[model samples]
Target: MTIQLPTEIWWRILDYLPSNKVKQLGRVNRAFLEKARQSRYQSLVIYEYDKKTKRRLKKIRSSSLGHYVRSLTLCVQAWPASDLIRWDGQTGDSLSVVDRVRSLFDSHYLPRKTVALKKKRLDRRIELIFEAMTAFEHIQEYELIWEEYDQDCPEEFIPEVKFASSLMTIFLSMLVISPLRGTLTKLSLQIPTHIALDCLAAADFPFLEDLKVFLWKSQCSRAKDWDILTGYLGSENLAKFISGLSSTLQTLSISRLDPSINLDRDFGRVFDLLCRTNFPFLRSFDFCTRSRYLRKGTPSLDRFVRQISHSVRSLKLSHLAYDTSSSSPLHHLDHRSWISNVLSVQGLQTRAFSSLTSLRIKDGSLSAHLADLSALLTSVAHQLVSFFLEDNLLTLKEVETVVCSLSHSSSPLRYLGIEPRDLAPDTFDLLVCAFPGLRELSLSFERFTSSDDDVIPMTEEDVRCMFPNLCLDLGFFCFGLMNTAGATADGIICLRLRSAVSLEIELCLMR
Candidate 1:
């Protein structure tokens, strides 16, 4: 007896199987193999070190499987130092394996697929791969990842050395070739800081609509080298890079290796470059730091705030703090001036976040720059609809002021998240009154015991009387509750009574 299954069911089952297993199933029988080789399995990955596997992949690329593959990733392991010195010699065992792997990609069997090439060797292999990929007529997305080598390596006897050197050369070649620029809409490139500066200064990606660049800093070096490297990434280079991009870019994210580097004047230059560029279609911008340094003469937070306030619709500020130093004056007039500039009334109007709807401020406790932040928020309260102040040092008065200000705004705010440390009973009551139309609320509070008299004395009846038509999120407060009742006009109250008081209560009393 033969059993017939629906096509949809068969595809669904195949979806759960691993790619290697799916490839095996395709080799099971002609009928099963044909269906398995469909476009549903379009993504392919070829590794250079895996000789037997890549050779088989090459065969598949030439067969019917080639027509179905839409996305391909090429990962070649970095050849060890021993392999580098032996390159001039006759074809060794490792070199032969590398050749076999390179042949598969060089064949150009699946030219239409999106290609991701990760290089472990910096040599001719990379150039060959790019040359082959360029032949494809319908490639759309391309990504390149290379191991960053900044310091001179000590002598080693490891195999695959030649491959590693080759990989580096491949990465350098990409900067000049610019093959993936015009066709790619979304591009992510992980480049060394030195090469990143070079690419920023020289290359232009006209058709790139979304770009994510991770610039890894070189190994710590002398001050002169740092200056030279940073000077290459000055405002001019930044402007050139942005100018080269298509005016249709919708999202831009610029990040630095060290949060301390973000405070450098070069960061301000990059910001200026972005502003000068024509990104009229841009809707989202994110600039973040991994940590903060309070070095003297560093660009203040106000400069960054001013740069992004106009065009960014969603903003996130994280890991802010002043670098500790005994030599540098902790309380300088310039520091005060910077703070004043960030909170300046004139700057607020000039860079009013008129388009801003979502704002997230994290790690404010370490930074003593709350005054400027308040001023900034006060300026843009008219347009904000979703505000999140997480893990910040906000007093009850400041919390009440911000909430009241937002309530007075004509904008329709639907979501609000405030830490519990910033709230008192009076402030909490003020929040409900100010944002009557709130749909979601998250509050984080300190430890609360059952015996504590200062607990929010909110009964089910009180909740029903207060928020008759709204959803209540009491999860963050850790308020212990027993009987929570929900009532309707019919006079019957649906009481959800928890038998015992637990550590936390998440009550949604629907009326």
Candidate 2:
């Protein structure tokens, strides 16, 4: 007897399988071939040949899987040997770009001479990706990454290794699609060096809704040219590109590799451009790079935030601090700039941060600026649903004040993160009592529990009894009911389910 299953059921079962396992199902039968291929091709990652990463996508170009792909990420290898005399200006050679790149892969190297491969084998890998991309359609997200390389490479990290100009020239001349793609809704790219899009500048991405860029700063060595490079990034072309996305973009995260990049002066033009555009649905923003610092009282970051403040629900200014020793013309910055800028905007006639709900302040403690932080919290407490204050700076009273505010006036804060040292046993109990509606609580316990009395009053059983759905994360063990809580975390993630929590999400039902 033969059993017939609905095609949807077959695909449903295949969805739970591992990607590699799903790929194997393509050979099981004709029914699985289509479903398995679709599942396998939904997301594709192509690691450049020069990377230490294993390459599994060499055959993707010839395959019909391109049509099924929705997410595509390419690690564009840096010209490892750009500085090498042998590799200089070879992109112009009559040799086909693919053939030229293949030669580097074929070359036998000598151990004594570390020629950054003179960017030897990188071209062919890039050539293959560009070739593969042309076949891609209906791709919803695109990412171009130039992975970081250790100092061992001949490339100088002080002045970031750049994508070779020759290769860029050729690629720009022939390259298709903007990093901000019209066909895709999400685009993320790392701008390690100053480069422009002569070919892609004109392309408008009506569908693009999210754009993340790592706007790296020019190395200190180029102090003289720093202004020029940064100014170039905020050129008319880039402004036009961002303006085009105003309608569709909902999330924007501009991170940094060089924290010192002055957002006010360097990123001013971009912010000016963004203010002119309106992102109706924009809701999440993150600038959590640990090293990023601000230079001005009303920095570009502040102005930019105000533009979308009305619509954004999640805002992360983690590691955003005043650069006391900032080299820009202005050396001393008021540390209170970040808080003051966001709060002062309420006086604006255009919009207030009416929809803001989540605020994450990593590496910042409220104790230093309790008054400023408190006032800022009060402004948005009614809308906030989650709050994370890492690097515990708030005293028990302060934490209590914030929690009490959330409990009484605004919606309950579902997520809370704090260090154990800041909250004594009694204080913790009070805080917990103040906010019983918490969905996740993160507590940092390092050396504090050395004394028996310093230990938290609650146990796995005690916590489980309070929040039945809570996922508790103990330092040593993470579980629900018993000592079931999982492995050690420099910090803990409270998993409020299963009467217990485990170290790895894979070990528990969370997976």
Please write out the lDDT profile of model 1 over residues 1-511, one tens digit for every residue: 3355566866876878876677676555654565677634355544443335435555654654555544444553333323332322333333346555766877752232212122222233554455435543244555555443444533441223343434544554563465555565665555444443444566766666776655544332224556545553444665576557737676666555543254446666665555555566666665545444323223434554555567768766543344533333432323432333444532357557778888776553313455556666666677777887765434566676667557654657767777544223454467668766665565553322232354455454554344454443332322333122211122112222232211112121123
Q: Each prediction's Cα RMSD?
A: 11.5, 8.5
Q: What TM-score does prediction 1 earn?
A: 0.61
For each candidate, the alpha-carbon lDDT, in order, equals 0.50, 0.56
Q: In candidate 2, what are the lDDT values of residues 362-401, reduced to their tens digit? A: 5443345555555566667666777776654454566676
TM-score of candidate 2 on Cα atoms, chains taken together: 0.71
Error of 1 at 490 (Å): 42
What lDDT score is found at residue 205 in candidate 2? 73
Model 2 residue 231 CA deviation in Å: 6.0
Once model 2 is optimally superposed onto the true structure by TM-score, how far is the C-alpha of residue 470 displaced, in angstroms?
0.6
- Model 1 lDDT-worst window of ten: 484-493
